[model samples]
Target: MALTSARGWQFRQPSVLPGFGLALGVTLLWLTLIVLIPLSGLAWRSSALGWQTFWSLATDPRTLHALWISFGCAFLAALVNVVFGVMLAWVLVRYRFPGRRVIDAMVDLPFALPTAVAGIALTTLYAPNGWIGAVLAPLGIKIAFTPAGIVVALIFVGLPFVVRTVQPIMEEIDREVEEAAATLGANRFQTVSRILLPDLLPAVLTGFALALARGVGEYGSVIFIAGNLPYVSEIAPLLIVIRLEEFNYPAATAIAALMLMVSFAMLLVINLIQAWSRRRYGYGA
Candidate 1:
């Protein structure tokens, strides 16, 4: 009888606060309301533009150029942020100096500043006759009202994301680890490449993904600097807005849907990379 009872026995644990069922229901309801519903509506709207029409819109020269400018400039900006952001995080985590706190706080100024205000400020600074632009004008370097201006705007806004994401992870690393590496006859380059980089890779990638996402979706901070010229400096988001203003809802929806799909695919790839890195490092294994 005891043997039979043991065979039939089962183990159970207490549910978390408010019970699993209620928590799941709330989570699903919130997601449906906020994310799923809106995205579904967008897809539905885009579908109204038949496949041929959608294809035409997507292949339009103006549309293609705008998309390219937006994604290309964003890619460049995120790459720049990754290099500078990692350096900044290292400095903040490893060193202590006068006014370090002030500098650290200033890194988040982009987050607090309004997007439109930031756009205006950047445009003013980079315009042909503006302060810094005046100095560069003689060198024949045009910044404002160009694609380079869009890149600059993106780099400004997306920087905080990379810095904040990497900072916490960097702080968690101990200096003693580097010291131990040095004691073992490892040169600075070897220690950094082998010991430090493996640990920081995942965090850096996360920051990069965040920065890229923000840059891709950015509109307000880009328009003023980009000059929004069709097939030249126009960004995808601005194109969408222009379509909407022209009462071309189908075209707008098609562009938005395409962006949504592309953004989702890029983020999914980044997440896969993060997962693979974690597994290779034996993290959470």
Candidate 2:
């Protein structure tokens, strides 16, 4: 009787909300309206540039430099965020102390603060004559108006994404797992690398991807601190704005399309890595 009942069972259980077809239709419609349509329109505009024009615009030295700065600084910032963000998440999850809640709340400040406001504040703190920069100036270390400044701004905006992404997953891990590893003669390093890391790898990759995406598209905060120097600190988004301001729509569209393609490719790679990590580590299993 059990075997017969099992064989008769449906693949999908009924839902209170709606059927699968209705849910999927709504999902696709929303995606089309919100995502697909805009992207398609951008591609259409870019296509009007002609392949040769598009390729030339994309390979222009100034455009290449801007794109390089944007992606490079973003990658560096995301890498920094992954290291510090993971450590911060671990601290928040594993320890308790005075001002713990306050510190935790501060992590979300970037999300709450307006981008322009954050830029102004960061500029105030890191400009040549500013408090932090003034101290570093004597030692000949410049933070503001440079690629390094862009990196700092990106890190500021992207850190929350990493911390928030990893925190919940860390919370879900049981303390007993670590204890068990220690009981089996595992040191702290071994427990973390062999036991905790495997489970955490997928989540870490997700956070890294989020941070990277945020960094790549960032504009306002970076602009205030980056000095907008051509071929030095000018970012792709800023370059697009420059093109638009100059009424060069074709050039603007070309840069935008290039950014979209590159961002999509990077995110796709990260997602593939996430999937592989899940399979290799049996994370969900």
Taking all chains together, the TM-score of candidate 2 against the true structure is: 0.92
Model 2 bad stretches (over 4 Å): 1-18
Candidate 2 structure lDDT? 0.93
- Please, what are the lDDT tens digits per residue for candidate 2 over residues 35-141? 99999999999998899999999999999999999999999999999999999999999899999999999999998898888888888999989999999999999
Model 2: how far residue 132 lies from native, Å: 0.9
For model 1, the superposed segments whose C-alpha errors exceed 4 Å read 1-18
* lDDT by residue for model 1 (1-285), tens: 999998785644464554677677899999999999999999988888889999998888888888899899999999999999999988988899999999999999999999999999999999999998899999999999999999999999999989999999888888899999999999999998999977899989999999999999999999998898898899999999999999998888888998999899999999999999989977669
TM-score of each: 0.92, 0.92
TM-score, structure 1 vs. true: 0.92
Give candidate 1's whole-model lDDT. Answer: 0.92
Highest-scoring model, lDDT: 2
Every candidate's lDDT: 0.92, 0.93
